[model samples]
Target: MDLIHRRSNSSSTGRSNTYDQLRSSPYADVIYDTTSGGEYLMKLQIGTPPVEFEALIDTGSSVIWTQCLPCLNCYDQRNPIFDPSKSSTYQDLRCNNKADHSCVYDLVYGDQSYSIGSFATETVTIKSTSGQSYVMPETIIGCSHNSSMLGRSFSGMVGLNLGRSSLVSQMGKHMQGAISYCFSPEGTSKIHFGSNAIVSGEGTVSTTMFMKKENHVFYYLNLDRLDAVSVEETRIETLGTPFHAVDGNIIIDSGTTFTYLPASYYSLVREAVEKVVTAERVTYQDDDSLCYKTDTMDIFPVITMHFSGGADLVLGKNNTYMDYGEGAICLIIICGPAAPNFGEAIFGNIAQNNFLVGYDLSSRLVSFKPTDCGVTQDIPIDDNSISAASLFQFNIKFVLFVFVLSLIRL
Candidate 1:
């Protein structure tokens, strides 16, 4: 399973708005690649005949969706729009009366991108590198007839969060509530589910994971302290005026490009790094990133993040900073909006590079292990691991009833 990164093609104005929206909302559903700060895409097949397409893998959203045919208004995509009418296994889940029974969904992103479509069920298939195929039937999906402001690289999104409609939750007991992924700086990466997702070996550390009552679409972790090696150790609670150690203080998101801290705390981190590095300070007018005129990241100090349960993640220059232009490197961590408006911090994917990160939802734990993601061993799968009879049985009528009922309640 190789993940594809999409580069940014938007103008400077659009890029600025994307950054501002991400900083203000912790739950933005934008897909990020390394260049454009978007997300990783996975190849999958939808419908009975199997229409293969690449979809954005997001941890901040729920509901699997793709642009469908007869598009009222849609953005250009690399692949052709999916035609539900041509699929033999597609089911509309129409009500008895059939006059106005279509289940419609309107999903809006923080950057004002949106998808509007009807809810339906179809067969989904995922093929592993070893040529083993995992077929899931009656998978709920949104057939987006109207959409806007989406990139052309990927056709749709695959939600991997803790929400009920997420792919992980819909898989039920088969996946055992587990998932793992390894991200490389460049080239392809891998993501696994079920038993193959377990992370265990030397240098592996586990930490507690929290799920908010109001928001279950994000993975939360607590940051106890941070130490700029050979510089200074600052407790998170003591850095900001009224900051305190709370469970799930920071969210670990794979769709975001940079790590974000509160404005007050980020100022302290900036000052500490300025004193340690000898590189000439440069202003990055594009965004609120700290840039330095240096040829190499060797001048930057190693940053250690001490999380709850004694999980100390040691980040090198590659994980802490990135190349901005010809002769300048900028810190990947930036200052987010001020407190009250945006209080939660973000642990973006840049810091997770070169590490195998595993999440065990049943155990409520997340594990991290340092590994060269670019050249990692592949997990072998048994040909008979999953059978057609073992697939979860779901009632389409019942699902439509509940979905329509929820809309009525709202």
Candidate 2:
């Protein structure tokens, strides 16, 4: 799948600072401004005649949903709401003969945004880079009738997580439980599934991927230590507390914006950063994030995250810091909970920019390889493929979503 960045209408060429760009942008929202909430969007065609629509690509979520016609309550969207009556292939998934046997789903996000709808199946079509259209019949989807707080740029969301109802799971043997995506800092990117998703080349590092019985949606990886040029290597267990390293510690999530570490470990990392950075210190009043007033991001030190099995991910300045407008830049890594009750630690997408990340669920391994994501790459299709079982082309659009700790199904 090929991905492209959706550009804002506002002119950003002559802006002296990020602050000016943020202020001039029309899509700026209260949550984190326009730039911070950016996410990748993909196009999907549903039903017999095919109603094409753009959807946000979320790795944290599982269900694929789009607002439907006769919406009792819904947020404004760029595309027309999907009308099931017009599609010949659309069919509601009825669990039983009961009057209320409609398979309904209620998805609530961390920011209190919600989507309520009936589960259904439809013929979905996605075009590959080779101009080949891959069709999947009877694909599970959520036809949302009520929704709130969704971005106006996209008509729906395409979830790429490891859930039973997800597109990957529904594809079953066709996808072979494999998926991979490469996110560029700007311009176009690509994602692969099944045999094409394999990441085995030079400079590629593989780490063990484990899942919790309670939550299978997230992809968890183990962190051995962290290293900076000037500071000593900091290990997770040495933080004056009992840390669980065997059960898989941090989550590598594409939906999240910032990386999160335990408070105590985060403090150590912050202190190490403070020692290396020579720029004038500043404070961001909005989130109190670690900020520095600097003209260039080059002053920031590179961070090396050592994961289990010799996977050392080297994070550069662009991966570790975010422009907080003005002359200030803030670290994208934030503190989560502390000690005994340590909450979920997340490895966000900012640090994943320019990397070809692959998840092979069958092998129970996740691999990473640094690459120039901005360049266009051909979608590698299997030559022996007889039918269009699983293939999707996605245009990457940056949209942000605040994840809730729990996904509530009502």
lDDT against the true structure, each candidate = 0.71, 0.71
Per-candidate clashes come to 7, 11
lDDT of 2 by residue, 224-343 (tens): 633211233433343343334666778887766678887767777788888888888897886667899987888887777877788888877788888878898998888775211136
**Candidate 2 TM-score to native:** 0.79
How far out, in Å, is residue 310 in model 2?
A: 0.5
RMSD of 2: 17.3
lDDT, residue 371, model 2: 88
Cα RMSD for candidates in order: 17.5, 17.3
lDDT by residue for model 1 over 1-410, one digit each (tens)? 32221112245324443332222211111223543344677677899799987777767678888989989998888788899999999997565554688788898865567899988999887754223356668988989999985454578888888887787787676567787888776667667777667788999988889988866678988776433122235333433433335566678876665688777777777777777888788877766677888888888877777777888888868888888777889987777673211456778788888888988988888899999877745554444334333333335666888999999999
Those runs of model 1 whose alpha carbons end farther than 4 Å from true positions after fitting are 1-38, 93-99, 128-132, 149-152, 225-243, 338-343, 381-410
Model 2: CA > 4 A from native: 1-36, 96-99, 128-131, 150-152, 225-239, 337-342, 381-410
